[model samples]
Target: MTTTFYEEIGGSDTIRTIVDRFYEGVATDELLRPRDPEEDLGPAADRFALFLIQYWGGPTTYSDNRGHPRLRMRHAPFAVTPAAKERWLVHFRAGLDAADLTPEQDAQFWDYVTHAAQFMVNSLE
Candidate 1:
C-alpha cells in the first residue's frame, strides 16, 4: 500500500513544526499578520496543524472539531488579494523548507499549496 503524505512527512510532529515555523513568519509579516487579529497565534497554529493533518490523509481531528473546512467562507472576511496570497506563500514556503521534504514530496506539496493559495485569492489586487 502506498504511504500517505502525512506518514511520509513524519506525521503530527512534523506538521506541528511546520505550523509553528509558518506562524513564526506570519507573526512578523505585515501583510498576513493583520489578517489574524489574535494577539497570540497559538489558536491559529493549532487549527492549521489539524487542517494539514486531515488534508494530507492523517487523523480527522480538524473536521471532528470544526466540521467541514469551509475554507473560503472562513477566509471571506479577509482581503485575500494576489499580493496577500504571495505573502502567505512566502511564509508557507519557509515552513515547507523547514520540513526538509524529499524533492518529489516537496514538488507535490508545493503544487498543492500554490494552487490553494491562488484559489484563495478573492480579489484581483
Candidate 2:
C-alpha cells in the first residue's frame, strides 16, 4: 500500500486543525511557556503551525521563512526537566488524540512526539 502524505493521516485541513489545537494547549501550558513575557502566544502558534505543516508534508512555509529548524539549539536556554516533559506530553497527547487520527497514524505520530520530547530533555538538575 502506498501512502500519499495527505491520505496517510488526513490532509492539509487535518494538519491545520491539529496544529491549531496543539498550539492552544501550548498557550496555556506552564512547561511550554511563552518565551516573551511581553507577548502572548500568537506568534509562537504561527511559527509552530508552519513548522508542523512542513514537517507533515504540507508546505515549506516554515523553512522558507525561518530557514532550518534548529529545534534543540533554539530550546537550549529553557530548562526541560522531567516535570516539564511530562506536562508537555500531556498537552500534546491531548491535542493529538482530539484530532481523531487513525490508530496506526496515532501510534506513529505519538512515537515521534515521545522521541522528540525525549530528545528535548536537556537537564535533570
Candidate 3:
C-alpha cells in the first residue's frame, strides 16, 4: 500500500511542528497578526495542526472536533488581500522549510499551500 503524505511526513508531530513554526511567524507579522484577535496563538495553532493532519490523510480529529472546515467562510471575515496572501505564504514557506521534506514531498505540499492561499483571497487589495 502506498503511504499517505501524513504518514510519510511523520504524522501529528511533524504537523504540530509546522503549525507551531508557522504561527511563530504569524505572531510577529504585522499584517497577519491583526487578523487573529486572540492574544495567544495556541488555539489557532492547534486548530491548524489538526486541520493539516486531517487534510494530509492522517486522523479525522479536526473534522471530528470542528465539524466542517468551511475554510473560505471562516476566512471571509478577514481581508485576505494579495499582500496578506504573500505574507501568509512567506511564513508557511518557513514552516515548510523547517519540515525538511524530500523534493517530491516539498513540491506537493507547496503546491497545495500556494493554491489554498490564492483561494483564500477575499479582497482585491
lDDT of 1 at 41: 96
lDDT of candidate 3 at residue 15, scale 0 to 100: 83
Query: Where is model 1 poorest over a 10-residue stretch in terms of lDDT?
Result: 116-125
Question: Best candidate, TM-score-wise?
Answer: 3
Q: Write candidate 1's Cα lDDT for 1-125 as tens digits.
A: 99999999899998898889999999999889999989999999999999999999999999999999999999999889999999889988899899968999889989999999999999885
Per-residue lDDT tens digits for candidate 3, residues 1-125, read 99989999888988887888899999999899999999999999999999999999999999999999999999999889999999999999999888868889889999999999999999997
Q: Candidates' lDDT values, in order?
A: 0.93, 0.76, 0.93
Model 2: per-residue lDDT, tens digit, 1-125? 66665557776667667767776787777656654353666677678768877787777889999999999998898888777788788877877877868888888878988999899989995
Q: Cα deviation of 107 in candidate 2 (Å)?
A: 0.6
**Over all chains combined, what TM-score does candidate 2 have?**
0.84
Hey, what RMSD does candidate 1 come out at?
1.0
TM-score of each: 0.96, 0.84, 0.97
Runs in model 3 deviating more than 4 A are none
Of the candidates numbered 1 and 3, which has the greater lDDT value? Answer: 3
User: Each candidate: how many clashes?
Assistant: 0, 0, 0
